[model samples]
Target: MHQIEKETVLDVRGLRTEFGLAECPLVAVDDVSFQVKAGEILGLVGESGSGKSITLRSILGIVRPRGRVWGEILWKGRDLVPLDEAALRRVRGREIAMIFQEPMSSLNPLLTVGLQISENLAAHTDLNSKERKARAIELLDMVGIPAARNRLGDYPHEFSGGMRQRVMIAIALASNPQLLLADEPTTALDVTIQDQILRLIQALSRDLGMAVILVTHDMGVVAETCDRVAVMYGGRLCETGLTADVIADARHPYSLGLLRSIPRDVAPRTPLYSIPGAPPSLNALPAGCAFTARCPVAGPECRDVRPSLETTGRQRQVACHHREEALIHFSAREAAQ
Candidate 1:
């Protein structure tokens, strides 16, 4: 049986975000583009300073005042780039919501969890205080918080890290958003808790039919949770494709490097692979492919001319001058290992 195609909930095209002086601003996100369909989970994976978080902020029009954003962020066919705060507010939290990376910082220490959830209900829905309280308890229960009504009045600090993260998820779902932007939702948690949170998010996406853009640095998480993956480096996307395809046979050197770096079930005392060199500074990005310095297969052209993202196969795109060579070269090496 053929699966039905989902609606496109978000379409981002040529997204660029910058900060600093207009004359020589530092580019944080450069010409990044992707789409999210309803009931799909897209993983945005990269190392620190790869602009994955910045890309998410740009989509929601939440970049700071000093920052500038260009290109299009179409949410349900409506352009969000040009929308003012007033207009964006109508869509934010109600139609789309975000689960920030750190629940401790994102949640208010002064306010109770129930009040925070109710605040969203008050803003987006016409529910009265009595009804909002009821909804808040229901949300807490939905997120697996035990004694939901009893926990409503508890302050954020009173909860453990995992529980606080659950509260954040509950709050984000208060408005029952169609789209959810999760920024490292499992960060700073123990492995067991991380698995639990990831499972919860997956279940919520399935049950609610909510589209998700999950930002993280873990390839393992992407492999486990995402339907599709986008790999970023130096503020630009290097690869985008279905998760299984990208993981099985990465075409870009950067993507291959990331996959290789993941630890496997190997003999004891085996040295883990690590990608060489740190990412380039945003203020001093190269004119050509940003990964050229670290890329093993880089040529003169890779150092002098930038590579545009080009289609390599069905639903797969790569920005590389030697994508075909990389595929052949890496495949042979992996097979021989």
Candidate 2:
């Protein structure tokens, strides 16, 4: 683990995203705020439908038309939320790029991998056709594709699952983006291939000085790759801090439950810890704490008011009515076991 330099590159402030124009609009992301510094890898960890993916999409201005988004997506102090389509085009690929979960789907089956990568360079850079083609080959080589020159002409279906993912990464880095949004980049791969992709992303971020936001449900992946983490639940960030702090001593009940669900040194066939109740419906969320129904330590006060995020410790934020007591008891319980 290396020390992260604290110079904010992307600052998301008070972000709120919604879906539906008809009755009963759903708030998928609510008042989410976070910052990514140069070369930092921030992990957004939560179960499916926790707004992790929506929050990432909101930053890149890729949310669908039905999805209403408002807030500041500050890239180097410039707000992207108000930027028009043409202006956003200038910022999207060259400044920020994303590697989606499914690479085979993200890549074009009709086009050669080289053409797909060079398209970004052609659109965003001043490079001529020959130079763009050369750069595309270089990107393919950089992402560790074997036989880069020959493989450049291959279509998405011509490559293996991991190879297709590598092609996606090459295209994403074609414009040399400063920020990379990776939405479950390794979810579809086997464990061996997942480790390889994670290492590739880590190495690329270090070599390129690119900030990264990795959105996934795998806490183990977060532990292995992230510098800091933000844990979301029911469209709200429940806890956030350094990876070490959040994993070892989680303050929020939801975060704690997530950590406990990871199989540790327990006996074989042991049932994993699962949080009670399903995630709240965004279209009809409860007035008070969205997690109150599932939280084990919930009390009367938790049901009366929605808890806002508050500073729980140094560089740690938690949204819970019982954070203080929960931290103390949770820490003690872990120590005991």
Candidate 3:
């Protein structure tokens, strides 16, 4: 076994979450499973409402009321889903931390940024108020906030968007977590700032030996930052493999469609093809394959059978029928079609 796959810090099995409604239930996350190894960055990529964010939230035991969650969320051999809220809170930000999407909303507008960070440290650590303040400044400094000692007195509104994100990351890292769940951390930032944030996350993953789960919609960012990637469609995982392998030899029609829609920078753009039809709504999933409606090469078989995660190679899996044909000379096939 590869070192990356063997030393997994987080292993999710058969994770499924459904929300109740009057007529139909909203299956936000459906049987999605993957492992994040120690010090590895696993990127979760998909369109909005693909359950990437919801899955991360469920891991934190923050799934909404009327939501039925099944399966195990394993961390260090223990199941987290069954843990009480108080126990989970203690585990969170210490053993496992999360940087939520939209740092501005996550941060307290009224409190000083340092206090916000200190509160996290105070919750987990036995540090005194003075000691916590010192640690909070150090955390801010580690995240590249200059004059952090002075910045401790400043509120979230005082800093720019990028700086606010750094503070959010600082708070997430305050307790020295073993795993970091970054839910679309760069979604609201500019491209230049996004690169900076991604690089910082990569640095932290390496420097601290912390596993990172990066939830994002940008395939290009995954190509740059993630060691491995999993693609989701309609609350289900479509494909997963080494970032390079998945990008080069995608074995699912949904994966192929995502790659085709976003032509790489090196590729000469030819009208920048878009996938036909929108992503399926979680409240009303299609029968069999959720992506059948949009898949270019979808067949009757795809419409009749729902494929589970099938290992096509070591540490590589794809949920799709006609996987063989999906990996065939995609560029040539596109031109010919």
Model 2 agreement with the true structure over 268-336: per-residue lDDT tens digits: 886666777788788767777878988877889887798999987878999999876776765776687
Candidate 1 lDDT score at position 5: 89
After superposition, candidate 1 runs with Cα above 4 Å error: 328-337
How does residue 111 of candidate 3 score in lDDT?
96
Judged by lDDT against the true structure, how good is candidate 2?
Answer: 0.89
Cα RMSD of all models vs. native, in order, equals: 1.3, 2.2, 2.3
Model 1 weakest lDDT span, ten residues long:
328-337
Candidate rank order under lDDT: 1, 2, 3
Which pairs clash inside model 1? none
Better of 1 and 2 by TM-score: 1
Which one is best on TM-score?
A: 1
List model 3 lDDT by residue over 139-217, tens digit each: 9999999999999999999999999999999999998999999999987789899999999999999998999999998
Predictions in order: lDDT: 0.94, 0.89, 0.88
Which pairs clash inside model 2? none
